[model samples]
Target: MLVKSLNVLILIVLLPFFVKAQTCGITNIALGKPVTVSAEQQYHVGADAVDGNVSSGWFAPGDNNYIYVDLGQSYNICKIKIIWQTDGRGKDYKAQVSTDATNWTDIFSRTNNNASTDSFTVNGTGRYVRILIATRVNNWASIEMSELEIYNSLAGNTRPSVSMTLPANNASFFSGANIKLTALANDPNGSISKVEFYQGLEKLGEVLQAPYTFTWANVQAGTYSLRAKAYDNQNADSLSLPVTIIVNPSTRWSLLGNQGTNPDSVFLGTTDNKRLVFKTNNAERMTILSDGFVGIGTSTKPNAETKFAVNGAVYAKKLKITQTGWADYVFNDDYRLPALSEVEKYIKSHKHLPGVPTTAEVEKNGTDVGEIQALLLKKIEELTLYIIEQNKKIEEQQRKISELENKEVNRN
Candidate 1:
């Protein structure tokens, strides 16, 4: 709260100057300490055309590019062109947009050899705007920047609109049942940044993006209005009319976060091919349910430690080898592909990996008295190299046959 207030104070103090930086129809964002607006400098592909003035860290000049700008506001942006110091070695420019600032979606970009002027238009939200140099030339042209022109229609139509999708508008959720909520939001001149969940005037929690879900052991038995409101990155919002949910008292299960660390943690935990289950405790991370499913990300041991889940992935932090000896690190259980050592060792000694030795060992250690269990097992892997070789031979034979048929037809 203190930091937020300080940032607001700084923005207000410097607002007039920043806003006046652009000559006409330009809004200079006063991003204070609390809000970050830059990324690391990247220098690999195109660097000749990139403007390195703003940030020398994240935006390194690649082979065919110069620099990018993030408007810091989402509008029904139509047309925008960059005026830059003329570099004679003329290249192509790309116009791109984004919502989260990380993953950029290119709307329109063009390659050009003209050193005089270039322009483009796109629709998106977020703070980043970039001009990528598509082709690098030996020499460069530096053009002086004069102005960024915007089409007039989009600037005045900022309004928040939202749509709800889930639980059928009017539905009842039993106590301890999973409740998923979804909403699509639009700002006529901006983009929705976050969604706030509310029960009456009390804020329950917040979701950063759309298609949100909130689940837990429903405790209070009554009809409650589930309200969802969306906010732009600037905290501009549109609130929805409350949806009704009947909270039953009979439901036994509830919801839990990974290790119950942060409040904004996603609730669903994956176990094997099924969803993970857990019961709530007073302080400790929502307790692991007894038998229903499994814990967060512990593929080898869930009865033991807490796992961290980023986005929707659960990671096993500590690896326990023996009763006490353990290794402290992170492991993604979903991608727990066996190592070559583990596969080779298990194939030779145990029936863990699929190999010829596994079948042979099973025959030797058969417990059934009447018949041998190993009729012989073929592994999918053994046929991989042979399949490739066979395909190549088949293609060669087909080519040879085509040539022979052509020769015979010519002779006739």
Candidate 2:
């Protein structure tokens, strides 16, 4: 009998209130509306915008209060959405969270304004939460809020970390054997990331870059390739393609020139280079690499060490520089202006320049005599023929000298 009576009494109270107030355990926290507020309880932050206590006449004429909650433990927080309780529709709340309450980190904070979010992630672990009323969007009034929640997040997998881009790529080794590898691979699923080189088949010494390269001196002469694979915290690998490279066991880039008059910058121009800028190497070689004479420096001075490509192979020689940057001023002086003298002889023979009057010298001097234009055309032809003939004759003479010497030795 008593059980039946209690049941009936409980039903009467709950039923009438539901029909009257349309709320559960309803509390009159503000105005006629019912609010459920308890930091201990969990609820999804819903549509209630900064609905802090600002509108309830509870906030002093110019008062602001901050509210926040702590998740208690560190979590990989990717996203968070907040619901406000301010009567002006939550238009005056600034929200923030942190591992330490004293130090505040912004999740989303606005003063009398609305906030939006698609997604974002915090790097590490943290705790603490809060919302403060910075200003009144509707009125400079009170701010009050109720209800809070802590989101449970799915953690991200750590990417296989590279301790180093691994050696200066320019670093060389004599052999490819026992290449060291080192890396830090950890996963939520426990050990997913891996370190690899020469595709995936050749298992490296270790799994990472730390020990990736030990003593390249042991590697034999030839070319090789390298690469690394990163696994998500999930242990899935990204073992990549072979990044090609050359293993030059034999040293090639010699200390061509350095210091003193030879500022290493001289041997630089190539199709790969554009300008002549000075650069210094570890060997104290001040070097310049460029493409053409378009660079801002003087023309190249050739010598035995002055290597140049001829038909794709390097050619070096010791030769007398017939014409040089200072050729106009110096070529005719003490130096054997063999080339220039030849040119002068030809000009005298042709006796005229192209496109000029027949009596150009007289014409240029006083009246029309010869065309200088025609004379100049004659000048180039003479100069070219002279240089070609001279070089050929010299080469032929050298060969004959060598042959004669050999014959003399045989006779003796």
Ten-residue segment with the worst summed lDDT in candidate 2?
22-31
Model 1 lDDT tens row, 250-351 = 333234412222223333454455434443564333323434423343323322332432223445786443222111111223423345566678767775
Please give the CA lDDT of all the candidate structures. 0.49, 0.43
In model 2, state the lDDT of residue 344.
62
lDDT of 2 by residue, 21-94 (tens): 21111111212222222221123221122234322222222335444445555554444444334443346555
TM-score of 1: 0.27
* Shift of residue 231 alpha carbon in model 2, Å: 27
Q: Which stretches of candidate 1 lie over 4 Å from their true place?
A: 1-154, 216-219, 251-412
Candidate 1 RMSD to the real structure = 31.5
